[model samples]
Target: MRLILESKFQSLLLNWYSKNARILPWRSKPSLYKTVVSEFMLQQTQVKTMLPYFERWMRLFPSFEALSEANESNVLTAWAGLGYYARAKCLHECARGFVKNPVNSYRQWLNCKGIGDYTAAAIASIAFDEAVAVVDGNVIRVLCRLLSITESFKTKEVALKIIRPIANQFLSKTNPGKYNEALMELGAIVCTKQKPRCEVCPVKSCCKSYQKDTVHLCPHFFQVKRTCCTMQRYWIRDTHAFLLEPSTVGKVFRNTLQGLLELPIMTPQRMSVVGLGKLIFTGKRSIGPKDFIEQIYSPQKQVNSQSLMSLPEFSNCVRVPFDQRQRLACTGPHKRWISKLLQ
Candidate 1:
């Protein structure tokens, strides 16, 4: 990478970004707190989907001090609708850590709970004006096309050794914050994955993949087959309240959903003994590489809720009355299910 080319790329990118950058809420008045919250919420979530949640979160938590002082349950509740609950937990942890011992550098931020290399770089550069490059999915795609590198980014070594070095080389030292954002913005709106807007791309002449006409094939990726899964949940209700339980899905859910409630899961053994009851709600949800067919059931016979309470399964459950459902912190899916059931 020559200094002249780097300078040209930076000049082009910064100019394009200044004219076309999306007016995100955090971009208007960026602070360390806003940057951290937005980065955490944007992980594995699209800008459109996360916008509402981000606004709501800012109202609820406001600042690092507010978020750190909030209870774990409140934090989880505020983050309910967004799946990947782990990110919420990590953000909460980061807030607590920041409140305890504030950090300004990428290296220092990396020591926090969920601040990975990319997140640390983004926060440090965007909020603190550090001369570091951020290599998110969009940036990776842009880099691959710009340089015509066909190495699979699925491989960790390729991303770190090949992709990251190029990203660093292209980083604008004079104004790294704007430059990094410009590169990411370019990848997002113009250098898209499916059909890149090569004609209108600011740096199209400098892009090797465009010059070679290998734009689509430059960034190679391994395809992953998604698995299908079926799960059952019970919606047992008494006159006053509905019976719910803590999530028992897996270690990740248990950790993220520590203080939240969810509909009771119907395991194979439990289904065998208690039956699936009457199917009320059937829906499809996707999480990561797994597609889940979720079914909600009620008891076949009108068994008294109190009588079922004697059962060992109900011992660990909590009853949420219709009036108080709004106050309780339920999982995102379960919250929707319960709302539909009531309607």
Candidate 2:
């Protein structure tokens, strides 16, 4: 926390970051818009998982004008594989607002729906060079151990109180943007939750947790309890496995599944069975929980395309001919039921 150590601290991190920062598309040529998009997509999504999606999105909607011009259905389509539908909605609305009237201040960014405190700060500091710190999960872990703070960062209150001050003080005045990013990078690579490589850490000497030999115990993460909701989607396909578009009796299905063909879904209802996967495709899902479960059920038989299409559910959805419609697919994780239709 002293002047010399602080100076050394910032220097070590900056030097390391400048040399070793991961080469990402957005980081290569950063702009306000690019930074905003990356930050929004990065929320709840892994860097590797979001990489292709980000590149595709940038190519599709290169500017705020382009995004603002797109319809919600297309926007959602572009955001496929990246769950959390609400983020896409917010980003779309924000784009429209920005195109109408651009904003240059942190307060203005905060006014946008999808832009939260962390996102706003990241954009303001990284894009605009505002001397604010980003307090994401990585930053919290780094700071918690750096200063030997024992508080849980389950809530923003604890983070703001114990971690924010250190992060701000650690900020490099000459390049606060890179400094914030560097700190996050360090935590992600070196000061990890488990097996933290304290020896290689740039600021290990100045880290309270490292000095105390208690880096592992510093940031006590508070786990949020989450209950799984079972989801059921009905796949109504033609004789050739070409899916119906949920036009009539299941028009409601098409709204959520813009890119794919689907019928009425009976999701997250009562699931009588759940089991573990033990077969050829170990990693591939067979429905049910994460790291577990593969309950294979017989694919339901279907009537001729026209007959099923005429039924109540197929009234509104387009019943593209079996030969024309491509192999039917779902948006999220795959299920055995959908595959069985092909077999």
Candidate 3:
């Protein structure tokens, strides 16, 4: 029964794919290096956004040897504003690994730094044309809806058990690259997570969830609520410039900003103005009144005497009332610090 269902799905998907697959630069001239890089960039990122970055990255790196030889700072700089600095770090590590000792086998490639199951499978099948399954979020969504699978994939063991075989069965021996890409495209365009276009879906006839008119429900969507935290920051200004500091917290811009700056972060429980002043001024000894600038308050609140005593770093305090600091705490650790020194 599984074999029959999978065969039908493969036929429909591959047929539709041959006609409608997106013409991407990576696809025009697929290579092990290019495919690997594309897959890495594509994870949790959109195709349109990745296009320019991908082109620039390829131009700079060109090949595994070139990427391996490039400086880490240059790579990180190139990846700036892309977010997910770790991916850049991992990509560099993987390139270095490949350059050090090249291997022909996909299995051997998997053992390289930063190569996980999805990445390994994608590179192996798309670049090498090996008959290996590529299972990612798209593939998972497509499979679950087509098969009407209700089991929660929250568990790694259960997800692998359900998806591995399906991927293996549908993997095209003749053109695994096209097959893998076609599956991803079907999920991206036709079998979308929200409001799937079932009528246009080539595999609709084979999709049990589509037949039942419950394609969206089959995947069991989960939502996470984000909590917002409040923080207070001070832009200490001197005659020449404001002080900035490297954030100690592991966040988006950690090691980047320069200068000796201090900002008071306001928590839910408001600290007394005096406490705030002490917190800001106690640590520093170099800054003086001549170096200070007129305090600029957010919302332009008039500074009272109480607020003035709270700050120890400066004779005067500027109150800047930002709307609110909302952060996705679970996303990662963040170190909030003064980013620039303005005179």
Candidate 4:
């Protein structure tokens, strides 16, 4: 029964994919380099969100050799607004690795830095047709709903043990690449997390959850508590230049080799000297599990660079001219604030 059902599912998925797949840049022309770039950009990002970044990145660093030759600052600048700066750094290192030694298999890709199991499987299966199943979020959700696996995947071990075997079983032997893409596409557009279009789902009849009328409660997982924090940043400016601190210098920005600079955080000592300027920008942003309420203030009186630079808080800060700030690599929010301030 399982084998018969799997065969039916595969046919339905691949047939739907052939006609309804979105026309993405990477999909339009399937190449090893393009697949690598798209997978990296899509790590924690959606297709719509990463489309512009992918296009710009391809224009900036077209090939693996080109990306390998590019500097970290340039890479970070190109990936500035993408949020997860670490992915950019990993892609840079991966490019260099690919340039030196290109490998197509899943195991070989796993040996490369920052290429985890999912990424390795994706690249291997999608680019090389290696018959490996990719059990990403989309796949997991799809399978869980189809099989009515309601186990809480609070740990990686649990998820791998539960979902992986099923994914491999369902993966097509003749064309694993297209089959995997089709399953992911179904999850993305049809069997979505919220309002799933079950009526239009090609494999709706084969889905156990749909048959049982438990599609809404099919895929369940433990919820995580988000940490909320407030951040106060300063936008101190002199006549020609503004004080910006290197992201590498701060603890908050230590998540990655963020080669960008950000607006200085107003420490108590620094705040005592340079009073809070006019309120320039205030917004809330979430990265991973932490939610940040960020506020940027500009001082009313402009202090000289020498005095500001003498403070411990601004010791490593650089004075970037307003005109030249555009060229400098900066955190996403700071970059937008700087551009908006200029306008």
Best by lDDT: 4
* Residue 195 in candidate 1, Cα distance off native in Å: 2.6
Q: Least accurate stretch of 10 residues (summed lDDT) in model 1?
A: 249-258
Task: Give Cα-based local distance difference scores for all models.
Answer: 0.82, 0.67, 0.62, 0.85
Which stretches of model 4 miss by more than 4 angstroms? 155-157, 248-254, 310-312
lDDT of 3 by residue, 155-270 (tens): 54467667878778767777787788898898888888778889888988888988887676776644433333323444333323332223222232442221111342332322
- Candidate 4 has its poorest 10 consecutive residues by lDDT at 248-257
Per-candidate clashes come to 0, 15, 21, 2
lDDT of 1 by residue, 1-343 (tens): 5777778888999998999999998999888898899889877777888899899999999999999899877887788887767788888888888788889998998888877878899888999899889987788889888888876666544666678888999999889888988887887789988889999999987888999988988688777788888888887886777888877653443465555688888767555546667889997867666687988898665555666667786778787778988766777877888899887
Displacement of the residue 212 alpha carbon in candidate 1, Å: 1.7
Error of 3 at 284 (Å): 29
Residue 325 displacement in candidate 3 (angstroms) = 24
Q: How do the predictions measure up, each by TM-score?
A: 0.91, 0.77, 0.70, 0.93
lDDT of 2 by residue, 110-129 (tens): 89887887888888889888
lDDT of 3 at 310: 59
RMSD to native for every prediction? 2.3, 6.0, 10.3, 2.1
Residue pairs clashing in model 1 are none
On lDDT, the stronger of 2 and 3 is 2
